[model samples]
Target: MVDTSDLLPKTPRYLKVPLIILNTILWLLGIVLVACGGYALSKLSHLDDIINVSLPAGIIVIGVFFLVLTVVGCVVAYKEKLVGLVFYTVFMLILLVCLIGVGGGAFSYRNDAAKPIGTAWDKATNDERNIAQEFFDCCCWTDANSTCGSNCQVVNETGSVVPNLNKTTCNITVVDYVQKNLYVAGAAGVTVGVIEFISMLFALFLIVRICKNPRPKSYD
Candidate 1:
């Protein structure tokens, strides 16, 4: 079923060698992304509605894409197949679009990233609030400190425990943390986008190189 007319391209040592090395790094990165996302999903499935679960899910998707591409890329480079190279080049372009979209979307939604957390805080039970208060080292839901849980002592309550009021509020602290991290994610997306664009250019140039100097099928 082989095409008798199929030809292999002459690849430069400099280009081919670096491509292979970068592919290895990309392969390992793919595995890490999948594993990290899977762990987060398993451990914190309960936070799906409370937090943006899409982040981990998106990581998994990207990881799978990279893993699949690594195989196609390796084969194309090894066999010098024109068809496979075309697919690889197209996939890289698709990935570039994806990275840009993710970066832009995250930046646009940076301010809204903590809305769900704030809502969750408003609906949280005293036990839940106490846990958050202990973690964030804050009292109640707002600066009012009107709703102290066991984590923070109540003024009128009589017990062996002394009242310990924190100056900050839990809602403010939690929202600030989420917003800051979301901004970081947005920035990371843009950085990765630039790196990917350069990698894509390498693939594009390889295509042109192959087309210009392809060897006859019998030459190999």
Candidate 2:
């Protein structure tokens, strides 16, 4: 009888390609999260007493976790290690939960950012209000009637003189500023969470496939 074992087709290596791609995408996402978290921490450094510092720090920590996950995943994929794959998948599931929570919190916080902004304005003293008005180029919290003096002057971006009669208020300016940053953070969180969710599913699939088609043992 002819030896037919030699004619058997070897398992294609394509199964691992998706896992590699997903890990790479996750690594890039982690980098972005770290950058955003760092930037936010710097921007909010002045408000450390008012805002919670833990939020930004948590983001940075999560980013670092993702980076570590990527490294572990790459090693497991290269070595076709079943135990490492299982560990990575479990860790990913845990991270998915955290990411969901963070994304929800960010979105909710962005929606309600106006309250804290108004509170800050209310707490500021007259001198502080004046300094804010000068920096933001606004008259008062809501309108001229709120606190803007009768002779408040408005300057346009072109350095042209404009009547401060109906200029934008500090309330709108500050609220807009806060909301804009929050929006960016919220969107990023949601996007990263979604990507991670997909990654978790892909990883689980990879684990199953690897289990079925176990890598050949080397005697070396």
Candidate 3:
């Protein structure tokens, strides 16, 4: 019977420790992303009318993928499995492509962002309207109607505001809010891509190193 242990690739000491450290970073990053995505989805889902669910959902997807990569990387490093290392490198490439696609697509979407945002105003629930109004210190979408949300208020009595304090409309408020957050997401995606790219290089190096110098079988 053949011993399977000998088939594992030998991880050189120089790269081995660094690879483990990189995988640990991936693990922490995955946790942060998953948490952030989940929080955004749960706490801010009501604003979906103005912002798409795909944003948070995409974050969760990338976070989970990173988690998987962390496991794969750890295993390959510990077991010195060449096959697993190759797969790790492949997964890293796929992740990098996805990051570029998502980041690029999101930035493109931002270029014409106002169109959908303008349309979404009408579809917002009253609760969402109130939330946006309060946060942006606005009244109505048009602020033309005499009626207003919580954000608009008369001063006290004597020196009271003529109608309400906020002069801007919710329409303007929501648009600005969404655009800023979108920029943040795009930047974060780029950062993740950079990290994945570096990890990919490390994996490739480990693969070549293993191929050139396979670990010798143990003598009993």
Candidate 4:
């Protein structure tokens, strides 16, 4: 029955607004990352599209998880309760794991994907000398009565004929681009998804901790 009001400091007026804003932003980012990850997963068949559309999305989404963890930790630390302290500690640990997981995923994907692109670029560049204008000749191959190159342009990820003269034949270049990006993004998406899930876990922990702990009475 002893009064507990004096045990805790008055909550700061400035703190709550920032915490709420941060929490909302972090949550939004996590949600976006998941959505982008899903989109990337869905576009698995189209490597170029996957890379173009999904990789950056995954990175952003994953990056949000770290931000969320930071916000949650800040809130708990500022509050100065046993539950808050515990939540903060746990969240930091989770953030560490997420950092490593996402970093490794991105690194691994980039490394693996780079090799193929290097090869393709080398092949394309070397072959370009022999067939200097072949790419340009094939432009608009999809159109009727368009004849530029005698050899058929390579098929790309989209199943369209490569149709550029100045650039890599559209399909080959695109397929190569997509293939490389997809590899990189696949790794990235996995990492981001893991991070987001971990952030959510921390958020859950925070909620539970807050609910279970006793709050100090407003008046002393």
Candidate that scores best on TM-score: 3
lDDT order, best first, reads 3, 2, 1, 4
Between 2 and 3, whose TM-score is larger?
3
Error of 2 at 70 (Å): 1.1
The 0-to-1 C-alpha lDDT of every candidate, in the order given, reads 0.66, 0.71, 0.74, 0.48
Question: What overall lDDT, based on C-alpha atoms, would model 1 receive against the true structure?
Answer: 0.66
- Name the regions of candidate 4 deviating beyond 4 angstroms: 1-13, 45-81, 116-215
In candidate 2, position 136 carries an lDDT of 61
Query: Residue by residue across 25-48, what tens digits does model 1's lDDT show?
Result: 677767876886677566546544
Model 4: per-residue lDDT, tens digit, 1-220?
A: 9996544324432333444455555556566656656665555423332133444554555556656665665566356345664665566466546555655665565546545433433344323422423422323212332232435446679897663444334334434444565565555445545544554454444454445554568722
Error of 2 at 22 (Å): 1.3
Report each candidate's C-alpha RMSD, comma-separated, in the order given.
6.6, 7.6, 7.1, 11.4
Off by over 4 Å in 3: 1-11, 125-137, 143-167
**Model 3, backbone clash pairs (residues 3+ apart or across chains), number:** 0
lDDT of 3: 0.74
lDDT of 3 at 214: 81
